[model samples]
Target chain A: MARFKFLVAALAAASLWAPGASATVLDNVKQRGVLNCGTDNTAPGFGYLNTKTGKIEGLDADFCRAMAAAVLGDASKVNFVIVTDKSRFNALQTGQADVVFAHTTVKPVRESAIGIDFLPINFYDGTGMMVKSASGVKSVAELDGATVCTTQGSGTEATLAAFVRARGFKTTKVLTFENLEKLFGALQSDRCNAMSTDKSALAAWRGNSGKPDDYTILPETLNKSPFAGFVIANDSRWRNLLRWATFALFQAEEWDINSANLADRMKDESAFVQKFLGAKDGFGKDFGVADDFVASMIKSVGNYGEIYDRNLGPKTPYFIDRAGTPNAMWTKGGAEYSPPWN
Target chain B: MTTLALRWVHRNLFAKPFDAALSLVIIPMLAWAVYAFAHWALVEAHWQVVGGSFKVLMTGIYPADQLWRAWFSVATLCAMFGAGLGLSVRPGRAASTVVALGVALTGVMVAVAIDVHSGMLAAGSAALGVAAWCGVHHLAADQRIVLSGLLAGVVAIFVVLSPPGFEVWGGLLLSVVLTIAVSILTLPFGILLALGRQSRITSLRVISTAYIETMRSVPLILVVYWIWIIVPLLAPDTSVPGLLRGMAGFALFFAAYVAEYVRSGLQAVPKGQIEAARSLAMSSWTLNVDIVLPQALRVVVPSLVGQILDIFNGATLVFIIGLTDFLRAGQMILADPQNSGRTYEIYVFLFAVYLAIGGAITYASRRLEAHLARGSR
Candidate 1:
């Protein structure tokens, strides 16, 4: 019995054996009837749950739902499983979720050591800090001798602690909460003077607090971990479909198309827009989907810019300015670029 | 009066300076725990946080409307509990006090878990019926208490379960319902498997032993995962929901463990007892039931209680296959931004809950072991 249990644990611990010889996650998901998509149901503007609708909303959730719509053709066809920072990889490798869009940052160890594969960067969020106006703490440097609250096992906590220590900021107390909500709550409740997290999340905390004016995200880009979607590695076919589906959302935005306007935009003189929308040619069929798959995804959700701004961009609650950040489109001199749909 | 109280403590805790020194260290830790619990339970913790979201505590992602099926289950269990104690085991004064403490704890839970929906009332009434029947049965044997109690329990569960298919069952209640239902469900199977293990027939022994060993060898999660994945594969026509698969997996896993324990008890029974009953010319059925089973069960009562505790703890593993219980509920609640900063608050609650339930199971097992020992003596 113990030997059998050891075998099971060894399989779990050695999760990086690559995918099985045949089949893709797409097949498993299709057979299962519902898309087992992972998401954070707390990170505002990324993947927070709406109390009223009880639905997970934000950029990452939108991508998960849109992928579900593209594949399953129903946005509601998803079983939105929640995973925390510490448990995301285990959830995916164990097959609890078919796709994880839980603000999962791409790293080599995760791909190699942890045994999972990364999709395109779904949400670009980097580490930043927040402090009250009264503290006169404008940059990371001013946080000397300060007690900061953040979550444990997160890259942000490590970076912050290192940055403070490197700067020789003595008396810097780092308190770790299991989630940012607690860390932010402790910040608001005066339990801790400053809270740190990804820039997107810091802005999210500010917006969702119902009193956004009191919080300020420091201008320092302390870390650059881009949140990417992922799945269990080895299913290249399904990986391709999901990867292309993502870039298509970005391609749609680049073509000045959206769920509301893609139908009319398909008739434009530019052959690229037409082919991309499947108006001139069926582009999506060979990927195990309909030719109008990108059209449907754009129709169900929207283009990349629409998704971002609606959730995290400047006009949204996170109020993140996309014009100057890496999150902006290539036309705007940013990394939010995708290849031609064909 | 206080000095005398101190003197009494000194005698028990400080017979020697070393003992007194141990008491000094232990007393402060216990005192701190008491102080912390008092402040949190009475002062700091948020009861107001529980609103219409009662299902969050009861069942993680368990569809809310079907909660009645789960509530009705409580009455069925209460009825069985009362019947079992009345028919065979007599709970001592300490046992009765502990049971009252459990009731008080439930009452406290009721006060907090007060968002009772429609079917909860019927479930509540069913419990009252069993309590009344037990009272009447204890008062007078002529009242037909046993039969009435069983009927009320069954009917209540039937009424509640019929509307909401068992799929919507959830929360700690789901775990309890599953533990009780699965333990009862596994009993006959475990017994049969145990008997098969002991049988002289070659094929039956091999098959039963293989079944027991295979199940005992794997973790409960693997069996549940296999059932979750394979049930659909083998029987495409049958679509068993996640919760049912979880229950079935639990039954399979627990049946193996229960069989081993039962087999141990069977092994321990004195050969003389069996021979004496056989010498009286009693049939195998009568000897098995009247003598062997009673003695074997008494020997294994503590072990059985311990098994129930194991089943309760193992129910949490069902989450890997996506059936949420209490711990999963904590994760789900922390998903909300309002409750996001409340991980410390929520996890603390979960630890306390498991500890409390586990402690109760341990207490009951100890009490039963003592009772069985005393009865034997």
Candidate 2:
């Protein structure tokens, strides 16, 4: 009886860890005529479900539409599969989602151990601090003896400690709260001198605090947390298709070809522009899509900068300025770059 | 009348010095708290958040064009509830008042978030429910036929709602559907496990004990998450729907609890009843079914009803697997930057709905206890 139990346990473990049969995701998606794009419905400006429209509206959601347009020739042919922080990777591993764009931070262990490939970074996020405007503290360098609070058990706790130690602030005390709400409350009540978290979140909390001018976000970034989308590993054919589809958005922005001007650029006399837009000859044949797949994506969701502006720009409530951030195009002295379309 | 009211208050409030002092301090504070809460709820709270996101709160991202399926499913559910309630004993005054409050709240919410078509459907569903209740109550319908009919209604509702795909079934609708599915599916499996544990056969008893013990010891989230991950790994070719997988996890975990409840009921059955059935030379199946089960289930009816509430609350944990339930839906609404400051309104609404449903269940359980106890007494 004991041995029987042992055998049962072993079988269960074996089945759970066993490798699934690989099928090319591109073929499945093309045949299905719908792209299953996984994303979070709770992350504002990334992939939130807009209650008024009953539609997911954000940067990540537009990318899904763009992918659908590229692959199926219709932007509305995509189904938005809502995934949480815990289940995003499993959604891809189980073939439930063709690709995921859930504001996931690119990490080394995730790629190495989780059997998924990380795509190009879409947004650059990092730890940032916020202080009350009345305190008159300008930056991290001025908080020599101040107390800093962060959400407990988050990576920000360690980031805060390392920064304080490196800056040689002997009297700086670090505090941790159970959540951001409590951490913010502590800051408001003057229980802590500063509150720190992701820069995007810092901006959001400040924007929604009813009196946005009462708090000032410090002008120092503690660490890099570049966000990227991902897909299942060992499928370069599907991976390459998604990689270039993403790059096309960046390249379009670089070439000043937004949705508003796409038509004019398509009719341009330059052979390179025509070839790049798939008007005469294109890279789409090699990528297993239509010759004008790039045009379809741009037409559906616009260029990368436009997507960023639409979701996280000054018009939106959670606006984080992209003027000097790494999210800007390379030509504007930022890191968003695409290889030449030779 | 004034003198009598003063005397009554004096007798209750000033029976002891400490009691008088406590009443003096507490009554004014309670009144103030109630007034402040009323002021916030009525005057200060932004209810537009709830009105604006009513459809998403009710059905999540269920396509606008396919809302009729959800409405039809809701109508069927209302009919089933009405029929079920009619088959049971009539509610006491307290239960009636609770039901009236729930209905009034629902009416107010619907009026606030009114769309012409949905408003018509809501009225139709309530009418259908009332019609069902009247039909069952006046005609003296057979319980067995009504139960079988209700079962068919569940299947019909699932058929109507599933074609739009399982992924879109979310929000409060998802919570209710998942709760009902898990509650119904757990029943037979739980009974079998209970009987197996009480069986004379050693291997069967051991297996049932091991399963029940193992399941009850683990947290519910682990079971749900592992089932979600393992189903696809075990059957890599065919994609199992997430809603179905979530339901399976809930049913499996709750079955053990149901088993324990049923086992307690089984033990409560008198030894003499079993002896009397056996002395008549009745087969084990006939004895257990016709004799023992009725008594056992009667003793356990209140507990089983309470378990339905447990399942409803536990249904919220399905968000880990990406199925947005009622609580998750509210959170999704708050995630919108427009609704960010309306957290209190959304949370209060969710709290009121949960409290109403939970109170109704508790009232039903109390009524069942009284109803079942009448003959025994």
Predicted structure with the largest lDDT when compared to the true one: 2
lDDT of each: 0.73, 0.87
Off by over 4 Å in 1: A1-52, A56-59, A81-98, A107-117, A125-134, A141-224, A231-237, A254-292, A305-325, A331-333, B1-44, B65-67, B74-170, B185-260, B275-291, B343-377
- Chain A TM-scores, all candidates? 0.80, 0.90
RMSD in order of candidates? 6.7, 2.8
Interface RMSD of 1: 6.0
Candidate 2's TM-score: 0.93
Q: Write the per-residue lDDT of candidate 2 for residues A96-199, one digit (tens) a residue.
A: 88899998999999998778898888899899899999999987899999999999899999999999989999999999999999999999999999999998
Candidate DockQ scores, in order: 0.18, 0.60
Per-residue accuracy of model 1 over B17-61 as CA lDDT, tens digit each? 999999999999999999998898778766544443455666544
> Candidate 1's residue-wise lDDT over A10-58, tens digit each?
6555454323422677877777768878877556667764543546688
Q: Which is the leading candidate under DockQ?
A: 2
Fnat for each model: 0.16, 0.71
User: TM for chain B in all models?
Assistant: 0.81, 0.94
Per-candidate total of colliding backbone pairs: 4, 0
